[model samples]
Target: MSSALPPASSGQPPVAASPLQPVTAGILTALVGFGSTFAVVLQGLAAVGASPAQAASGLMAVCLAMGVLGLGLSLALRMPISVAWSTPGAALMAATGAVQGGFAAATGAFILAGGLIALAGFWKPLGRMAAAIPPALASAMLAGVLLKLCLSPFTAVAVAPVPALAVIVTFLVVGRFFRLWAVPAAVAVAIGLTLAGPGSAGFDTAALALPKPVFVMPAFTLEAAVGLALPLFLVTMASQNIPGLAVLSAFGFRPAAGPLFRATGLGSMVIAPFGGVTVNLAAITAALAAGPDADPEPARRWIAGVTAGVAYLGLGLLALAAAAGFGASPPLLIQAAAGLALIGAFGASIAGALKEEADRPAALVTFLFTASGLSVAGIGPAFWGLVAGVAVMTLHGRLGRLTHP
Candidate 1:
């Protein structure tokens, strides 16, 4: 009897057929990207004073923005350029909590951040300013912002042991076997636990209602612009856009960064009224669409990028369901899921922050100050953290020069 199996399937890992390869990779990219950090987005919006409806709208809007922009960029550039919501920015918002003017003011800050991002794309000085920020300080700030949420898993265990442990255990086991699926698996377990609880019947009804945009007129305040907008733009640039470009470079797809930044920044501005905070190039998930796994030939990998965009659009349709499910769960439980998702990022940030012994003192100051939750003169810890680090570095530099001279 003759077998119809492809030769590779007999022993080696089964290779997807050429046409299906990009599609499969794209779908996986969307699933991993969306499933991993969406809770962080919703939590961030809520912390920044968004009502449940507004938070859901923000989620839906960002999904759509990334979907549209990712597709456009990929098709135009013919490179696997994936887009994503800024996970670090979301965490920063969560850490910052509600500003003076509430969600409306936060919306204004989002607009400001969007404008800055767009400017960075076109204005050389603005882009150079962001690049001038020390890598150690930036990473330290990110790690500090993530510290609170990353502790949620443990705190959650104290609050609700059974569900928290279940999520953590699933995360560890799945991570050991299939690393990319780990966070999603933990999310699934948490959702199951949440919906299985009493009073979860309301989620079914809530899920049926489609997501709708909730427009908030922008109301800018000095506090919000300094505290929320600046930090958000810096974090998005350092953590998302820069790394995203590097990922593309690693894959040998060298599309100009300026156009991509402008696209995502403009997309963010368009969606801000609808409650979307920010969107940018995908860093971690870019690998899924740009890597060799997407296709044997680099030239054809844009198909995966395009497919990922379509998948994001489809995911946007389910925003209401996702919001409802997370909303139905206990805040800590949902936070635990979000925390687990951020572990890898936190680890990376910590490693980067501490890599250079020369810069370690400044990085340490940034991390501690940012993690202290300090708010002076209505500015957030993030801004202060950066300031403190810069001050320390400058003073250290002057002292060293004086001594040497």
Candidate 2:
């Protein structure tokens, strides 16, 4: 499990490193992580009935939590254990729509979810259960949750053809060469179009204000707990935390899971009352810092995480500006950028779900149900999708045994 980079073939040494390699990687990871999904987070908060101010508060809280936790964990563990807001959890919230008590109820559920995550750190069984979830089913559930948002680009193009197309084309072209820069490039184009488009006058630069915390007293309700708390925990664990662990393990960095989970969970709880939903280990951005590209020496890779954490703190300061920009821009433009950012995640989830032939049927069932947006009671399609997939997988296993016997 040595994380050392492979040695050069010849006697000559590898290229001399720039001191900025880790720093650059950290900055890139933070940029990609924040720019790619902050819009989606705002949209998710809105779907759950957050006022513009409340949503801004939530965004700020999560950003600060992530930055602080990421920095602390990286320094303590000396591993690139990047932390992030749960994009899948946000997507699940978006799918759940507004609950009985509206945003307050949802906030309560968020608190409960964060508490559950923190408890899971002390409860070995809970952590084990999360880890034991079939990879196919987990991946399928994530894919299902992501499907709708990923399609927003097309929807945006239909509603606002020229601007959406410009963004889309820019993404495709830039992604072809500099894959990492694709979403940022698209975001820049979308912003440019928004500033120049017909309704541009509505974006009052003077009105843009720094983000401030808008606390909402949480009111716990049965419906919100069942609908939001349970699903949020599941999606965050399945789609974000587990995958994040896997990414780190792939790079031969196996820090204790309980401490990591507890750190993020506590951070989430600290910010929940302020509108932060959940923060967890980051899967996508972790790879950028953990990889050899960040540092030739694996032990030194933690520097990238530390750098990213510092960068995230800077982004947190600009949360208000980001909120204002998204608020003033055309919804389609925001949707288009968010959708483009998630395209790779969608593809990865699909591939992960279908990688095993035996699990394909179950995975497809999960994806279909989740993508269908079916909600029974207050529970979202994501939870039901997991249920369906596991049921199918179990039945398929039993049938195979019987036939073979």
Best by TM-score: 1
lDDT of 1 by residue, 1-405 (tens): 211122344666755557889999999999999999999999999999998899899999999998999898999999998999999999999999999999999999998999899999988778877867888889999999999999999998987888899999999999999999999999988888888876565457757677988899989999999999999999999999999998888878888878887888889999998899799999999999998888877788999999999999999988888888888846667889999999999999999999988888989999999999999878899999999988887877832432244
lDDT of each: 0.90, 0.85
Q: Residue 161 in model 2: shift from native, Å?
A: 1.2
Worst 10 residues of 1 by lDDT: 1-10
Model 1 misses residue 369 by how many Å?
0.4
Model 2's C-alpha root-mean-square deviation from the true structure amounts to: 2.9
Off by over 4 Å in 2: 1-3, 6-9, 206-208, 398-405
* Candidate 2: clashing residue pairs, number: 0
